[model samples]
Target: MIKRLICAAVFSGTIATNVNAEELRFTVWTGSKAHLDMLNDIANGFKQTHPDVTVRYDTIPFGDYVQKLTLQMAGGNPPDLGWLLENSAPAFVEAGALADVSKTLHATENYNYADFSTSAMGLWTKDDSVYGIPFSTSPFLVYYNKSLYDAAGLETPDQRATDGTWTWEQLKKDAATLRNADAGVWGYETVDGQGYSARVWHNLIPIIRAYGGNAWTDGTCHLDSPEAVKAIKLFHNMIYVDGSAVPPGEQGDFFSGKSALTVTQISRVSKLADANFDWGIAPLPAGPAGNAATVGQAAVVAFAQGKNKEIAAEFLAYMTSAKNVAKMAEFFPPARKSVLEGDAFLSSNPAITPAQMKIVAQGIENGSVLPSHEHFPQIEAKARPEFDALWSKDADIQATMTKLCQGIQPLL
Candidate 1:
């Protein structure tokens, strides 16, 4: 009777352990095989320690990522972990949508949490609580067609950068000279050619910062500041006056060779794989204020409302460990100080040379993430029409920007 009772007890323990096995669902915006393969490898690494867990990544469209994630939470089914854009970090942190991973991050053996740069971590942390970890702090760069520059008989941005003569004024001059109306080529394309509508802030903020202005400072709207007005006027002239930039409702793709120059980042290299023209990436041109090195960032976050918060936080810690981060640097610019300072990051991307990668490293070191506010969505909504107005030749630059501030000030 005693032996039978002991056997029954052992069987029940086995059943309970089997029931403990859990699968975590992760959300991401990338559907790239290389990215997914790396992620799966990381997950497999986690299983080496916690053999009972499984991780699955769900690809969300970039346009609907935040909204759909929110809906899933509201519908009682939230992803255990997910990617969050820098623009959404402030709002998500304020809304209590992300789990606090500080404990897991710090308690992990040899994690070296302090290896992350303070400037790079600013958007993901508040006081002592870490809500997210940035995986990419990609800087905006100037990608110019070498073929176009050679044919136009002009010194390329790289040459200008080497001599410390690259500036917004020089960029304007090059754009004007490169304009070839008969051949249907544009001199410049703004943020994937959706500048006038979708990427309105992205299209203007770098220029605004270069001119020593910002969207806001200390809860005050400064879109109408004289410096900002001057910056907007410069881009307006590029689009309407000189007709050097691709105007609204037009298709001028830089990767497709229809545009001479574009301002973007290294992640777009895959788009240039089969390009017809030779291209080179240079640091962003300096304005009167000097190099701003504006960056767009993204991070990984564990959802506060997830069913498996503890395990998700553990996975987050593993995924962002120094080794894993260095591994991810092949595709994503890492925020880890150790990785960024090492030799691996310089040659991570085979498509780009070490020289061009140096510009990326310097940019991340000196860069600031895109301007963000807790009420960013509201600010973006109110400024859209006013921003749209700036694309016209007859637009009143100062007054239009003033109106933008008026609409955004109440939210700020």
Candidate 2:
């Protein structure tokens, strides 16, 4: 009776009634009031079809997320649905921790499952089974301080992106020109200041990819390739030679106006909402191989251990439908091709204009998700000390990369 009612309501796009009530627990890492508010709105909308169902969102700090979630699953108290990072996807899917939602997704009426991009869906799928749905397929972009650019008497990234001169070399020159020792302002900040450690891969992949270097291909390591070494050398020069990037221990926040540029996703735009200076978003600088856009993705998954697995998958389908994905484009960039190319997504956020949003759309159309492996955590642990070795003034770029690759190749 419940299944028939759900199918009927979903097909008719109307409300269904049930005397028995159920609540789903969904875990996520974001604690932002705005993000929660938007999420709550979506959750409430789900009651239109499943009138007796309720969704409760649990917030976990990012650093402790995977650990706590693993504990919950081990303790036999896993969330019905949860948001899983790209790096964790392979591990979770391999362990059979996630429920297969392909049947539920395909069974939902008017779902238009094909609207999601193939690249965006790559991580959650394995042959005949689908374990999750990507919720955020955000791309790396250059966020520039337009006010600082104007004060420095230099063109901003957006202007250069328009003129076809926004290459990595040009960015390096701009960073050098904008460095202001007297005011204590830095030229560039990498991926939220954790680039050298926690976000080391995110810090290097775009630059490496733009230079035609890849982390690995078909089980072979390429971090020591000539293209990769050159890319690392350029960044190394920026830190020690140019003294432009905020170094390993230093503090410089682009959103706080202490840095002139940053590489981040559209979600960070909320940080600039009340900024004291003008800002704009632009595509990542190009390289010899042209621009190689990189994306960071997160997916919504149902746990295999959940008591409410079927209903959880139904709600997942509801939340990620084309209409809701369009609504979510304001904060979480959508993976749906229909929403991404639509005019509504361009104007979804009041803080960003349509023109600026187009850069994000183009990036989604071309970008590849950041590197992920089943052994990512082990690889990150083994590669940390090697990465730390390269932060010094006279670190040998070629030798360090060669050593780093040797250590991680086995883990891969």
Candidate 3:
């Protein structure tokens, strides 16, 4: 009997050691307050079911996230798990710093790949393999001050949500109606120029795609095509010819109620909730090709050097589960269709309407993921000066785009 007790004690000690070995470290660059709170909740939830495993989370600011992540990867000490933006994933994937998470994600029963937007999935896939599970997925929407619109005797933008009739032409007309210099208000405000060139690119890409133009073709820059040139010309016209959108330097006016309409990400709803005026959101105005699209932000990935890959993947699975994803929607929309369509997810935020959510869902489903090549950063760098010139109405569209493409081609 004494010998049996000794054997049982040794077995118990072995189990304890095994359990203690199952710890994971995850790094996320999400800096939003609501997102961080939801992440903590998910972590705590994981700990409940996974008593043997411990998860440690580290936060990084958005500005330094990529640079810091790159440095850590170069030093061969990347976190067990990290957040990867769609625009930045290709570069890291090319460096072989990310694990091919396809198999692990596929093995999980509740982890449904089909439920995520194709564009969201496209961001983390190279060739035929997927590297990450999508997290926050957003699409551009029109946020308008209802008081401003009503005071101007204008119809609410939400009226056009179902028919996709909110065109650039209509938006311009509405902007003209709302402009009032004496009251410090304008019809529309958008972030443009080199300082916020990505914002211009984000809004413009949908228009380009809607007009049947590909931003890049066969791994080469194709922004100089007839359709693309027309798209750029129209965008330029909005600021220069239409007198509807505020100039680049005047973006702050919109946040201060100087503009009636602002094109922004759905994630900004939280920020706008406390504004002095009543606000409403509508789907992005449709373009010529009878479709709409928007740029997506970031997803979650696993590092190649992670010691606890299995546990890391499990944690990711748990975090992205429908229940957990519903919690995350308090900050940003979850990537899963199941979560997006569920009553729990929809009922959490009464501020966002079901119609608006449908528009976002459709936009994400139809959206194109931004292409990420090795020289993408370089391409963006070279293109910005010309885009700035275009916005300032000083550059010839054809000549500028042609030159920009030439500079980007060599990088590709």
Candidate 4:
């Protein structure tokens, strides 16, 4: 009888342990095989110490990321952890949607929370609460097709950058010269071909900043400023007058060899791993105000409503440690100072040469994160129609910008 009781107690304890086992769901926007493989490798490492834990990654398309994430939360099915863009950080933190991982980070051995720069942590940290940890403080770069440049007997963006002659005006000239209509190739493509719609800010902010203008400041709108208008006109000319940029209703993809140049972050490097043409990355072209490097940032956050918040935060801490951050530097440039300055980071990816990686490092050192506001979603909604009017071949730059400012000023 006593032997039977002991066996029953042991079985009960085993069931209790099984009940405590966790499966964390993580959401990301990337569907790249390389990216998912790297992430899965990292997730597998967590199982070393957390033997009973498993992590599942869910890939949501970039265009639907924010809206779908919100819907998931509203439906009480939020993932335990997810990636959040800089633009979404402010609103998420304000809404208490993200879990505060400060304690977990501080408690983790050798987590080195201080390794992340104050500037890099600005959007993720609010006072003493850290809603998320920035894993990618990536800077905008111009990726050019070296094969096309060679065929055309033109100096590449990399060469021009080295010669200190790579300016916005020069890029426009190169784009026009490289345009190959018969080959179904465009001179340039905006970020992911959604630049005119979902990514309009990503499409225009760098140009505006390079021209010595900003979206807003101190509760004011600057899109209607003289500098901003001049910058917008240059891009408008590239689309309509120069007929260089892949405009709205077009389907040119830089990775598919349909465009000569594209403006995007280094994370897109994964898309070129098996490409047929030679490609290289360069700093954003200099403009009237000189090279105004802009960064697009994203962070890993634990949802406050997660069923297993504590374990999710632990994984977040582990995923962002110096060692893991260095591993991720292959695609998502690190926000951690230790990893950013390490020699290993420069050679993290076999696809990127150390020389090309230097351009990424330089941009991160000099760039500012893309503009973000707590009212960003609302502001974006208000500015959409106004920006839509600017896509026409005969659009009036000054007038459209004025309307955009008028529409978004209240939100600002």
Most accurate candidate by TM-score:
4
The regions of model 1 sitting more than 4 angstroms off are: 1-21, 47-52
Model 3, 163-237: lDDT tens per residue? Answer: 556776677778878877688777777732222454556656766766667668777778888877887777677
Residue 208, candidate 4: alpha-carbon lDDT = 91
The per-residue C-alpha lDDT of model 3 at residue 124 equals: 79
Ranking by lDDT: 4, 2, 1, 3
Provide the lDDT at 118 for model 1. Answer: 80
User: Residue 292 of model 3: what lDDT?
Assistant: 58
Clashing pairs in 3: none
Inter-residue clash pairs, candidate 4: none
Give candidate 2's error at residue 202 in angstroms: 1.1
lDDT of each: 0.84, 0.85, 0.69, 0.88
Better of 3 and 4 by TM-score: 4
lDDT, model 3, position 158: 80
lDDT of 1 at 247: 90
Give the runs in model 3 whose Cα sits over 4 Å from its true position.
1-30, 50-64, 75-77, 106-120, 126-129, 191-195, 241-243, 253-256, 295-297, 306-310
The estimated TM-scores of all candidates read: 0.89, 0.91, 0.81, 0.94
lDDT winner: 4
For residues 1-412, write the lDDT of model 2, one tens digit per residue.
2122222322342221221239888999888787888889999999988888999999998766776777666644668899988988887777677889999999999999898767678889999788999888999999999999999889889899899999888888988888888998899999977789767888999999999999988877899999999999999999999999999999999988999988988987888877999999899999999999998999899987677889999999988998888888897889988888888999999999999899998888889889888776667777878899999999998999899899999978
Per-residue C-alpha lDDT of model 1 across residues 1-412, encoded as one tens digit per residue: 2122222332332211211239888999888777888899999999999998999999997666766766666555667899988877887777667789999999999999888878778888899999999988888899999999999789999899889999988999899888888989999999867777656777788999999999898889998999999998899899888999999899899999999999987777777888999999999998999988899999999977677889999999999998899878877889888888889888988889988899999888788788888777667778878987876779999999999999999888
Worst 10 residues of 1 by lDDT: 11-20
Worst 10 residues of 3 by lDDT: 10-19
